[model samples]
Target: MKSTKLIYMILPYTRRELPGWGKLFENLGGYKSELWKDAPIRTIRGKFHQYLMTLDLSSWHERMTYFLGRYYELDIQKFMIEAVKPGDSFIDVGANLGMITLMAARCVTPTGTVHSFEPNPLVFKRLQANVSNNELQQVTLHNCGLAEGESELTLTVVNEELGMGTFTKIPQQDESLISNQYQLTVYRGDDILPEELPGITFIKIDVEGFEPLVIRGLDRTIQRLHPVILTEVVPEHLERGGFSVKELCEIMQNYGYQPLNISTKRSGLRHHLQLTKLTDNQMTENVLWLHPENNLSSRLEKYFKES
Candidate 1:
């Protein structure tokens, strides 16, 4: 298992040096094979720890690759593991399959708590199964979604891509591909979490295009806790949701948070972290937002220096 993990980590970087081998591997059924057809539940080690993941090969091939460490987002996962402490409280919005949620659960164990929210009934079931299989007692799962207000909203689930579920209010071009639609309850974060959570340190948001609504709901929570946030920033998706990338960034800026580009470049056996101004285009899927007053930057610096 460890050897396989090392190969998955090194193969991507090695492929850059030997470009011709890509074709050779493709000819050997490497990319277009039914590798995970029979495997529904696979246990793989993440960058920080090992956990079980429920797989849906039908619509989640990319996510299955992530679980296998073949094409995982190691840098983002590493940052999350380093940012959370043992007693910290973390919130995972759009916790599909509990990947980051499980990582955060491991980081803040015994005394800490991880609150994960997933709206899609099918995906929530998988997320629940993963959490239960791992026996993460510190993790709490919610079946409803969060938005600026409390109301019923239409959630459209795409047949081929379950992860692409979005609010029907959002104007998505792929409406014809929707397989099912369900009315789900949406709540404001402040309303659900009335009291200040203990030791709140980190929050992750990745709700396809409804990020603005999610942030709107967490306005008071951000003002009070000021946790380090990691959120997806897809321009097209935001526009579909009736907002722009600039609008999202400005909203975070209002809460005293600055957007920084989180990138990873390989250097020998290490993946070096690069924090710079957000200059990348919409292709950069995720960005880290940190409050000016927080010590997260210094803490990350210390972690990388020692590593």
Candidate 2:
């Protein structure tokens, strides 16, 4: 059971105030390093939420900012809500505090389930806390990092101010606090998925520079599920990692998926997942792809012809 008892204590107003809180807790002897503890419960939108303390998180504003920033993009939720079939499963990689995971959990409720993974232990704690607080029994949280294979790698914390992080195949050239780095355990989704996860129907991938590596690990899963894949295409980041946008699309196509630019006008339910190459639209950051079985291409073509 989740520990929902409230700790009515003062928060540190300055850096100097932190040590006392640390010492008081440390003296309790139950405070273990990097171990997760249940926090006071709060309510929002008629849902009770548990605030998880994560050392990796820079500040409280980090969670607030992430939620507020993506509030306007309700479109992502709409797609899953409309497209997901009963008993389907959704996978979220680079789940970062699980802003999208919460939505997936609610939409795929009753029969469907959500499998979310976050690399940063700090972020994973918050994600798990939120899931538990909301009583989201259908969403399973994994703390493991996703990569090309089951291996070890170093991850760089981008900046506390930006609340972002990145992983590299090799260590950074120069070490700096802004580029705070840590060695982490990595596993391929192909190798990591449990034997019993229901067939995945949708997937969202946004692992910064490590997208290719993460996708490479999921080739078998992608082929088997033919799930709708929503991924971010960072041309510069991919280029830095020796991957190109073209190569990424080709990889998806080989798995029987077509790229569907969300910017295009929609005609039918099926068009929501069609792959439309966005070579012309340079302004957008990410585009989605749909399996041909989803029938988005034909719906789009018919609409364009009629238009």
Candidate 3:
């Protein structure tokens, strides 16, 4: 009964998606999956996308979307929409439930293609469903992950968050935190991708702590295509993949790329989450690597003006 009033706030946002949450009145003392949540919901954050998300309200990725129209990285969406275009092959190395995949699919249309890779069987099902429901024929889903080379790795998923699965095992004091383990197939970027997919326009790779290996696997492919790469770059996460932040940047810089400070966090009550740049010292998580030779300035000139 504590959230009686709060239920009203969630009701307006989640009414139809909830299949009638007014049933909350029926069971004031308890909460059940059947009473409020249902299978396959139209995500508020997606473009009317039908997603088979978990009923767990504690998951930030799933929960935040209930309150705000969009959660997750706002800048990532902004960058993808602006950078991607029709008739361009966009690659998502670690597509979880096809958020960016769906965005790229709409951006590319049927003329182009989207190659999305998600190795987790549970998460792949959700990602596959989103693509199928939207009839995104241009998207070719791959139930695998990118690594340094062709091999099988044990993926660990915890706390029912499918997006959090990773090949790099986390050292934990309590093993009970590990909810599940899956043997997943992985490969090098150049080996798996068809030669026909030349000149990839953009790639967004976020494979938890295995980002460095994924980047290494794409060494040849990136050198050849020089696509704009949006990647997660946590220092500790890179260490898990046997790399430092400096080493990762060196690898990218060797391929003629430089990082750009795209967006930063701002105070909530005082201001909206406006599109702004973060100082180099502040940018520690995600980095957008631009290729000077191949990247079209026109694509981002509207958002980023030259000094």
Candidate 4:
């Protein structure tokens, strides 16, 4: 089976009565439903085979919100077309539903590898399903969460709807929420260092508010691999976790990284911040960092050219 053809099987099994299935089909067969009209789809093609998968595309308003956020939302298809080397390794720390994992797998085709870690059970199930459905041969999925220490930790559900969880100390006032909360297994990066794992060239961390903890665990690994790390650092979340944005920047700088000023309007590089400004009460959603003295400007120039 060709790699491209696997996308057609990248589907979620459904028990829910879809509009075009069973009894519902009889009533809507001739109708023009918006759901079907705007169904998300992706096409994959290899040398001689092609396949299509139906993705759960976001609404226009949701997309607008994503655009409003200064985050690097790469073009997955184009990324697959370029950038990924044959033997590179990519790690996705906060892989939600394996969207970026799938994209990473597609880009790192042939012999590259992708390590995806997701802790939320609901999202983890979906991620596993997507990885299997796509028949991604080079992707490895892990269920354990990463943090500063290796131990069993109680994670409070911050947003039940989005399945976001936090491992920070929950307020004593929120004991009721903690009672029914789920506890997850976690491993420190020092316990499983970069030398132990395969070579890692890229890492994406988006553990809502847990970035500092994750980095603390990976201090040695970062010094060793020095992979291009993309992390989201929300100030409020950091403060709640006992850190601040300035401190986080200092931590990254201590590890030899310079903060990259990501643009809020477009997918282009801006002037890198020589020194990031932050207040004791300042809050920003996301930021990107690159290794100091790294020729990131030239790299981005080359990447945008080839990509």
Question: Local distance difference test, per candidate?
Answer: 0.72, 0.60, 0.69, 0.57
* Cα lDDT for residue 205, candidate 1: 90
Query: Which one wins on lDDT?
Result: 1
Kindly list the per-residue Cα lDDT of model 3 for residues 1-307, writing each as its tens digit: 3543355456453434344343552344124333333323334435223332332344545544553344346677766666677888889988987777877887777888889999999889988877887778889999999998999899888666668887886767635778899987899988877666633478889987787788889877787777888889887777766677778777777787877756634353221222333334444577888888875555676565332
For residues 41-160, write the lDDT of model 4, one tens digit per residue.
332222111221223323332221122221124332233334345567778888876656766776667477888888878667878877887788888898878998888987666533
> Candidate 1 — which residues are off by over 4 angstroms?
1-47, 60-67, 168-173, 279-283, 302-307
Winner on TM-score between 2 and 3 is: 3
Ranked by lDDT, the better of candidates 2 and 4 is 2
Candidate 2: what lDDT? 0.60
On TM-score, the candidate that comes out on top is: 1
Candidate 1 lDDT over 83-109, as tens digits, reads: 777888899998877778888888888
- Once all C-alphas are superposed, what RMSD does model 3 give against the true structure? 6.0
Kindly list the per-residue Cα lDDT of model 2 for residues 202-264, writing each as its tens digit. Answer: 788887767788888988877766667888888766775677788887777678765655543
Model 3 whole-model lDDT (C-alpha atoms): 0.69
Candidate with better lDDT, 1 vs 2: 1
